[model samples]
Target: MDEVLFRGSRKLEIMQVQAQLVASKTKEVFATYSQATKALISQAIHSNQVEQLKQNIAQLIGYVLEVTRDFKYQVTNILEPRRLWIFFSTVLGGKWSRREVGIACISFVIGGAVGLGVGLIIRRRETIYRYMEAIQISHYLGPEGATVVEDAHAPYECGQHDVLVEVKASSVQIIDAQICCGYGRTFRRILRRIYKQSSSDLPVILGRDCTGVITDLGKSVKRLEIGDEVWVTVPFWSQGTLCQTVLVSEARVARKPKNVGFEGACSIPYAGSLALSALTEANIDFSNAKDKRFLIQDGCTPVGCVLIQLLNNWRARVTTTCYKRALPVAKALGATDIITIDDSHYVRDVHEKDPQEIREGDQKLLLKELEVRGETFDVIVLTRNDCVDLSGFCTKNGRILCTAPEELLSDSCGFFSRLLLTGYVKLKIVIQNTLGLPSDTFDEAHLCHATLDRLTEMVEDGVLQTVVEKVYHPKDIEVALNHVQSPHSIGSTVVTFR
Candidate 1:
């Protein structure tokens, strides 16, 4: 009986040992999975998969430490700050190279080892929040003129307003502020004052229109919650539109169209919505404007293209001006009547011709010459600030939609009056994208969906093209800006962030 009992006990011990082995093997498998995830995340980051890298970095690192080894201390507490600073300088300083990463790592280890070690010993969490660095424009009524300056961006708190939007990417473009029928410079000055008075605590966010997954929800937010990918636009007063983070009212949030990437969709809202608003302000009624003649100045520009596309959608007659070099591109985007204004002979002939000849093109002459002949159109859309003299030539009682300012406002009263006063020649603002606007003041999401959708469609359908004659990386910002300011350039200038 004693020998039999010993054998049975031995069998039970053996089975217990086997169960332990299985558990150990399972953990090893999990550790391997964690390592794979880390490798993938590193690869994604290197590849500039910004959104995916953001999502996976934290969880993968956490899993690796927990399962691979019995790490008693927090690695992040030791490494996070040091790693973050190095990571940031590397990322924001310029495009990432293997050598740069190596240098950053070496410097971090040499300089921040003690701090990182202490942090690791004290920290329990190993995750860091991802944020994009952005440029904030602060305008002050300058001693010389309206001085626009850039400030370091911070975070924004969403008050009880209702909606919040995460920005994917923001489009940065320059417009002729004097002629553009918007209050960008004026509002910028106001924001500068508020920021100055607030001790520079104000957050700078970008993305006039955004398409992203919703990561959090507010208490009053009934329609959205965690994990809902949404597109949001803030109201005009919110300063969160130009940075990596954005907070908006619920009234401004909307669903993103699934077909487009977030980056591609960013400009849509600002460009598309502005067009809609401009049309609304004009009161020409898109549904009734079929077969009517409309003149769109500066057809080579994005806004001009947007205006042209919308008018064409309504099947209106469209006339546009393009430099001879840009004529092909403009035609490709659907310019029916194109006037090449760079030719001196063309200009002189039109100036000398009979007003009637200028009014109606004889097939040999351009439409601008016809305009000199006192030819009037159903709608005249001015896009370039310097394209035409606003003080002259607009037909009395003819509808005029302008995106740029013809002259600088001498004072606030004149500025406000021009914006408020309505006349025989109606002035309307048409913008498709909104960037660098305060979110606290305007509804951003509604504008994004309403405008961005149309803008994307125009691009995809070949109605709009990014005449990106040049691409300047983030580090080349100064060079790009200077180049753009030069007297002559055939195409539009753009800066891209990598």
Candidate 2:
């Protein structure tokens, strides 16, 4: 009876050992499975459909690593000799359970097969998912060249799709007024609130003034395709224009200019539009300007210089203000009258007489008195400076055009009073180029490319010339800006990109 009791105790111990062995083997199998899962996911990440693998497999690595660490400690501390003796007794005598090993093996095989099937099903679902890689341009605000805010992904207009354009070189106008006048902070606050309100499924891209070839195109797109060279304009708020690749509207594009390379063409989509608008307002008839008078205040500005030549070829009397530095070129461009405005009335009286004179004996003073006595001209155009008293300078019933950033008569009490009380003038805006107009609306017209091909012919024949002074590379934009802002700048400054 004592021997039987000892055998029974030994058998019970063997059964405990078998249970521990099964637990250890199960942990080893799980560790192997976890490693296989990691290897499979790593392979998938390297494929082209990497973006489609949105499953947080990296997170799984952390969880599995923790489980593996705990299991390893348990397995290392296992009492193996005692476990073996207990297993021997249980297998040989107690349950007659060698047949059950096949059952356990089959269960593990089925579980592994099921896991693989589910993994394959998940991978198949991911295969069809697509995502956008966007480029964004934002202000370099932080020390690491970060922005306070950036335009991530904005949704497409539902079924409305758009053509994506990637830029090579671009510049965004930063009105310092917006940043300095509290408007920027207020705007940023509003943007943060809006961002909080937004959902996270939005797409994101970044880019700035840049040019690049189209590397890919969506099935819905038609106007452009892969391998097309395009120019992209980035707005102040980064939306993908600064990105390595950007999307643009098909309508916003023109065929890349034949003469200018991609580097030069990139700027024209934005600044060229500004230049075109200014010239359009000058209203020089390409066919008939050869006999009219058109005056430019600072004839050397990009817009002003372009307008000068456009007016010159139109046969309009081209009058521009030039000091000693710019006089020679201004005259060479056919400036009918080049007035070097000074305190002396001597130079101005030589052609139009001293129109700005304050004394009766002075021509300017006399002109002022004549204007008061009801005198005017067919057209009066003002381009620079706010010192000109536009309300007081007009002739009765004459057309006036001005480009001073100051508020109009309605915003000034004295100026408003004159316009309201004096009933002599009937004002009509022939054309005013404000920020509202599209940039390219007047390019072909100003260049007279189609409307008056004769003007293009004249330009080609050296009868007309565009006044370009200096060209700077993209990196030297600050240098170009300095020259443009210089009081002594003579002609138009162009920053060429390579």
Which is the leading candidate under TM-score? 1
lDDT of 2 by residue, 1-498 (tens): 999999999999999999999999999999999999999999988876675454567677788999999999778656575675467657668654546655766999999999999988877543332233332213323112222232344333312234554444443222211222222232222223333422221222222234556655556667666677655443222233433345554444334444445544443343333344444564535664565545455555433554566566567776665445677777776667665534244444535653334222333443454355463333445544433444454445434554322232322235445445223221111122343443332112232212123322443465445455565543444454445444346554443322
- Can you write out model 1's per-residue Cα lDDT over 1-498, one digit (the tens) per residue? 999999999999999999999999999999999999999989877775687677799889988988756454456544776776567666688577668778878988877988888889998975544445554434321111212233443344445545555555444333322112233434433434443323231333222445566655567777667566565554343453544455555556656555655555544455556566667777765687788777776665545766776677678888887667667767776767877755444456756776345323422344447657565677777664543343244456668777542343422536556345322112111122244433331222335444544555565665544444455443443444444332223344443333
| Segments of candidate 2 deviating more than 4 angstroms | 1-247, 261-272, 275-290, 332-334, 341-387, 390-480, 490-498
For each candidate, what is the lDDT? 0.54, 0.46
For candidate 1, what is the TM-score? 0.50
Candidate 2 has its poorest 10 consecutive residues by lDDT at 423-432
Cα lDDT for residue 410, candidate 1: 25
Stretches > 4 Å off in candidate 1: 1-132, 137-166, 175-213, 222-240, 343-374, 390-397, 405-473, 478-498
lDDT at 128, model 1 = 44
